[model samples]
Target chain A: MATVEELKLRIRELENELIKSKQKQSDAEHHLRPKIDKMSAEVVDSNPYSRLMALKRMGIVQDYELLLFDYDKVELANMNRLFFQPHQAGLSKVEAAEHTLRNINPDVAFETHNYNITTMDNFTHFMNRISHGGLEEGKPVDLVLSCVDNFEARMAINTACNELGQIWMESGVSENAVSGHIQLIIPGETACFACAPPLVVAANIDEKTLKRDGVCAASLPTTMGVVAGLLVQNVLKYLLGFGTVSYYLGYNAMQDFFPSMAMKANPQCDDRHCRRQQDEYKKKEVERPKQEVVQEEEEVVHEDNEWGIELVSEVSEAELQDASGPVPDLPEGITVAYTIPEKDGASGETVEETDQSLEELMAQMRKM
Target chain B: MATVEELKLRIRELENELIKSKQKQSDAEHHLRPKIDKMSAEVVDSNPYSRLMALKRMGIVQDYELLLFDYDKVELANMNRLFFQPHQAGLSKVEAAEHTLRNINPDVAFETHNYNITTMDNFTHFMNRISHGGLEEGKPVDLVLSCVDNFEARMAINTACNELGQIWMESGVSENAVSGHIQLIIPGETACFACAPPLVVAANIDEKTLKRDGVCAASLPTTMGVVAGLLVQNVLKYLLGFGTVSYYLGYNAMQDFFPSMAMKANPQCDDRHCRRQQDEYKKKEVERPKQEVVQEEEEVVHEDNEWGIELVSEVSEAELQDASGPVPDLPEGITVAYTIPEKDGASGETVEETDQSLEELMAQMRKM
Candidate 1:
């Protein structure tokens, strides 16, 4: 047996170890474990994904799912507009977004990738990887949203999406950060990013050279939040097929001015892929089938039918049997009931009828 | 002393207790601790408040501060547009906002209050509490932002602000959740919330009653974020006096339309306080001082300022003293360099001849 003093020392050591272990576990609970396992519409405080999952409950989405980027580290500024926790400060932007969204609706499958989109190889690889799932089998992505800041990244995303024939939406905020714009590109259908040179490119100025040394551009959570909301709203509209999707929308927050316009594909486009896609679109349109309207005559038409019912042809015995046997499928709540002989007259009928056949039948019955 | 078995049992108990303690510590670190002591502009992943604090570095806000609510639990649904952590679920909405904002910008002074705004007594008490600090030395609240979802709450806030002669802004989203609006209200200078009843309230339908038993009004984080951003933006503009603060702006996300309009306060307004405010505004306008334009004639006007040397006024002794003794401010890069001329010629004569006389004396000297 050990001495009592030795036992006390052992106990103290165990207590210290226990405290560290408990701290670690608590940290894990706070930062690691997801809060929810699935989307719920309980409208309770515990439901983190309530608003997003509400889309499905509200009949806006058939099955709502999210695919977001996992590359950029979320800046402290992004916290104002996005659901990023302070403990997640050092995490990648995509990871932070995923972590936040997972807690909201853990059922939402997330795919994250980190890479500089400005490079051609990286852009192409990313596009191909998403378009054709690499390691695991997955469906092609429906829409590509470019929320990049610089012009180079925008060009790369635009180029990659154009090459893959993917539908993509581009979002950007002005340097002053008070204004923002969102544009939808349908490859061969709408204006490609390359179709018309960007404003800076049009002026033949290198966008990269415009940045002055030691000066950072201003950004606001409000501007970014608004832009992100607009982008997501457009995504829902496109996927759920509800409202009209804006082709090009610009927001000037200072003046609360929103300007919208549609842009046609440029005939003198620089990109070969865009030009090729436009040609294919034109060719497909020419070969597309035209639809024709056809009219047919039926057994009976209510007099209230537009233009009044016209008799095109005589009804056959089979057609008459089909119509009368099924009660002619009269409008809702209009039923025809026959009266029994014991009844003096048809009980439910309010109309006065003059029928010679009925009078003759009654006379024969009287003679019998 | 103690038995060996007892010591073993004690050790086991310590281990279990250690685990629990560690878990709690971890939870506190993740959910409770304020991440920042002061807002810093250091652009690093670890600094969560860097971006928000950068607003000061960017010269937008003089001293960035925040005032938020401290009551009502945050639901999962709010995660769509806000920085809500799952750990913050049980915390009141105001507390969650405070916690999150505190982590983002610990330097921002926070004043919190909890109360039902719809009740007149509660509103008055809360307003008084904030206006006259109950916990700390009193400082008047600058502007009140009415972000309440219902009409009664909006009316109460408007009334309170109007009574205090406070400037306030109101924000709301539509039932469909795809549209939103923000308006600025200057108690006496602009339309109060009650000056013209909101469209929903004017219809005499209770918004709460419109919600079905098992269904909630659909909400989108995007819509909320956009609205929040616009609201904050208007607040910043009102506070910092940089951009045009929108008086009434409405956003139609479906059509990507933003409509703006202005309305004057109704002369026959229902709110007695509003009517009183309008009258005070009229009285103040009458007593306001008028501005007058005063032009000084001491400075010599340059002849080439227009028409390239058309005669304007003769050069005076005072003008000569002002020009030679003190530097005459030139438009851009034309510096005045006087010549001593080896003490043989007048030093400032070249500029003098152009003006005309010591008119002829100046002209001869200028020619020399």
Candidate 2:
């Protein structure tokens, strides 16, 4: 039989659990950490391997898909070796990375160095070197995928991507013009901003978050991992020739701060020959090459600054196969097409997208 | 010549003055709104009326004070009319009576249908009637602050005082803890859990919110209005009230969410009270009065549960008053001679605080 002291202690323990369980109601000032053990049988019985397998077998392991393990139910320490902290049990980074790698195979690993971003270029340079320095010799392939948090970061990323032969994924977080987080470079696939015409930047860019995205003590890992991780996924895919290559992961991290992915087809795949063969083989009426889709659905098919892109629609699959009309004398480098309709004659209507050559765009705006 | 069409198309246009003058390099998502005219200023400008006046009058409103503001600021239009429509804004019995009589001196002519809370029987009857009737008398206060956004707002305020008389203040917002965007209710001191705990016995309870707060949203306006405007101010004063009262004339709403007075103290009156005085006072302190002092200290203290409350060399001037030591035949309140030794003591010595009745203390804990 338990003594009164033991009973009292148990009661106190229960009371503490209750206090923590009712964290939203508790007026005491303390961080609310949910009790991991003794909550429900479902979480208690399952291991991390099952979790990973569930998503993996589903074949839905797209970039930015978030899986939150509610640790409020089971004794985490009991499963820590299997589910979390396999690499390093006690350290915060190692513990975080271990859980992430085991469960989601989170591509981007966040290190909250707590250092100033301005003077903190050394680690960034080192990361760039690691990501870009190809393990092989002369026969370097197309590009590595990358992203950055802001213009300063983007500049750093762009410079690195240029060196590494990579493309950088643009982020809506950067729409707020925050200069903190930066991305690396990827090549071959068109860059996000390079394809889209700055729609998100115009849609967002609220005056309040003009200079910063969130609270002063904001940590980037929890939210932007998908963007960074997606970049990583693209890098691996470009390197390994994976099942399908998604150039743009259309994720709105700010909408809910959950890294969920959506695919954006490239806007510059205007070469009709690329579509004809793929369409015949794939048995689709017409198949726009991945690089030739519209940047954002909202933009008009044609814009004043057309940037050598044509409309995806208005041309039949047969028309694509014809390959007959004299190709419009377009710019020498890159070209894309939009599927969205134009108000006037389809030829003259214009659109603007979130992906901008900011230096050129800013120069044009400044002149205006 | 610039055409009239160009000039006619500008909506809310300002000159280049509206552009950000310099980059603010902080990270927080500092949420706020400003006077539309002040849009040219930084994202968040000062909301303190007292501070503005201090800058204008004396160049600083040097006082430590708590900050309190609701995320949902409502727009109210007021008059002496009764809200004949079920959903309308109007005046209370006293307010209607005053308007009907058109009394010159405020207290000169008054016939009140409202029961005075002076008598216990009357107070109980009043409370029961309101609760049983579901708290809406159809009688109006000065204004009805409705929440436009469906989001349930939360406001927690504390004043460094305990004893609150019958709440008799007009609120820009409503109270009584009804299940709505703006449910105003008095906190602990008046009509606590023992009397009018917020319970949704009569109304269809919102299970989601109930799950969040672990309680049904039931309430009384007597508590609500009392707590809404007047109580909120007191809460701010206590939370951010560094020195004392008696500061300005923005005095009320004229300053627009600014404190009129309560910035400075007689050089002698620090909140914990002068430490030297407390040391001297603790030796001869009594019990009941000490309890009273603890209640006052708590009333003035405002805090959010976001950060932990660290109570340390934390003896308040009031707590020190019960200083008389060694085998003193003390009352039920505080009898033990517990000095938080200027030097160190036992390992498990918790911070010294009020020894109040369990029932009374539990009532206070309900809010927690």
Candidate 3:
């Protein structure tokens, strides 16, 4: 048996060796990884291949089998006011939206329309009819989706969605129904105009662009393409759950923000849209929303008899208590809030309390 | 121009109409995505971009940066047990390591051999000597890194690493010099195994090969290669802090015997080899009679919150009430433990209890 002293000595020797070894790998990866990303872009810009790298780099990408549908010719959809026919009279956005519709694939598809007269009640009736049609035809429909443009039409989007989401959650497909309602709703998901995050899109604000476009400024092609593209991206990844999708994405004309959003895993902001819809949804029965059905991904941090993640405030406090020396780990149950406040207008939205607890905030959404 | 209620109505209409549209998008994604992925894989496999894309996709084909520091190169390092060489040596792993090394645009590359032998005394002495060398040579090294394996190393052959991870984070390099009797170790910005979760590599039992090579059961190159690959991946990524380095990837392998073994991350587990012999330096370390680190990549669930990456049974019943749910995010004073049973023969790894209130758990990680 070697002495403890010898073991210590040898371990030291290895440490130095390991450090030097790292230098070489470091250089290669530093230069190469970025190049890989660039190459991926190159492929996207020019190559025929289109599947991008996995979002999280978690290795395997197992796709969940989904209930695919098609409604290209039958269920075509677009807001006539915005439709641009680049390929038609001149490729317009609505045209692009149509193109997106035509090209999208899966065995089953739904047909939307070119004409519209509006009201949440009118839309709800139409949806109830079509949904019944699909159910009557004995077709399996797991989700209902819509992709639209900036600020102008998303409230109606949410209202129509709230009823559908509620029905999907409550009345459900009486016989065989899907469990959740995915918004692919873009702006609605990003929060209200005031609640938009700076990261999502950097809008260029010249006095001209600002005065001319105001909140409804013209969106750029690449940015708009990303929005439409992300719509496709979101739709493909979220429902069957083969890939991961971040909660929100935004494009700002004033702040010059486009695709400038970040991922907020499980946020608890009682924003106007979320709050308003929840209240609208729950007139009869309002119970605590099922926050968690199961504790899926959690680890118990038990350091120094403390439990959980390191709080930003407690490091020094705990260190002071243990003079014996090096603090091992941080305390648990501490998480930082990452809600970037959106554009809450002056005297505009409902109770904007900064001090709402998570439960309170969640309760607000549940009211819908 | 639409009225607010009209806008809301339109929003509701759009929302309702968009529902099926969104589902169509989802279904389309399912059908088209796989084809796109297949096409993309074909492009990568064919390697279209001549040098750039090929270099990006294939990833410096076999280049091991650690190869440059030969035995005689690093003064303080133990030449005998170099960090790692490809098992089938005289083969190109060294050339691979070296080729990747030469391309780097680093300001300087300091080569060394066998630097990461883990031990207290040796760590102390070498640190002192290096500091002295820097003072005398008039060239100071800013960081002292002990880079171990990345995610690739912890991957098992065909089935395992799909979820199980690889990588070890023990003593991180910080500006603060952590010193003890014989170990005056200073950590730099580089995150130690303590910061990132420890990579757990387990011996995979090859049933097919077991029947053929019978008794010679453990020949899992794919698994070992996965661990080795991810190790290099992290080493490279860590050196250049441009990308994300996941905090945890866990594994707890299922054994064929009455009892099962766990290959997991622990705050205290360092990647000092379990010891054996080879060259001159190996004489002192190798003859030292080692403790077995682990031989199989078992099953492990990694938790990303501040709570511990792996779970443990150390917390009692009263503790379980708080422990059962997701542990809080780790605070500075807490140590998270994977709540599982002890392994085959390992014993007495001290755990620090967390002091987070149960309320935090029920709200966050616990979500119960």
- Per-candidate clash tally: 21, 74, 150
Local lDDT at B201 for model 3: 20
Q: What share of the true interface contacts does each candidate keep?
A: 0.36, 0.00, 0.00
Segments of candidate 3 deviating more than 4 angstroms: A1-133, A138-142, A146-149, A162-283, A286-368, B1-368
Q: Against the true structure, what is model 3's DockQ? A: 0.01
- The Cα error of candidate 2 at residue A208, in Å, is 15
Would candidate 1 be rated incorrect, acceptable, medium or high by CAPRI criteria?
incorrect
Per-residue CA lDDT of candidate 3, range B1-368, in tens?
43345444544554454554445434423322111111121222121122122112212222111212121121101111122121212323334344322222111233443433234454444444334333225433333332222223211110111111212232111111101000011121112222222111222232233222111111112222222223333333333331223222211011000111121122222222211111222354345445421211010111112211112122334444443344443221121211222222321111112223323321322221
lDDT of 3 by residue, A249-286 (tens): 33221111112122111133224445444444343223
lDDT of 3 at A217: 19
Model 2 interface RMSD, one decimal: 35.6
lDDT of 1 by residue, A98-161 (tens): 7666765555677677667666677677877658752235666777888887767777777887
lDDT of 1 at A60: 42
Q: Give the whole-model CA lDDT for all candidates, comma-separated.
A: 0.58, 0.26, 0.26
lDDT per residue (tens digit) for residues A1-368 in model 2: 54555545554555554444445333211221222332221211122122122212113223222112111221212121122211222334334543444333223232223222224565464344435343333332234333333434433444444344444444432321111122222332223332222322223333334333222212222223323333444343333332223323333221111111122222342223322332343342236555544442222112222121112222233433322222233211111111112223221101123344323332222232
The total number of steric clashes, by the backbone 3 Å criterion, in model 2 comes to 74
Index of the highest-lDDT prediction = 1
**Segments in model 2 whose C-alpha atoms lie over 4 Å from true places:** A1-47, A54-129, A132-149, A167-170, A174-189, A192-368, B1-368
Please provide TM-scores, in order, for all candidate models, with all chains considered together.
0.70, 0.23, 0.25
Candidate 2's displacement at residue A254, Å, is 11
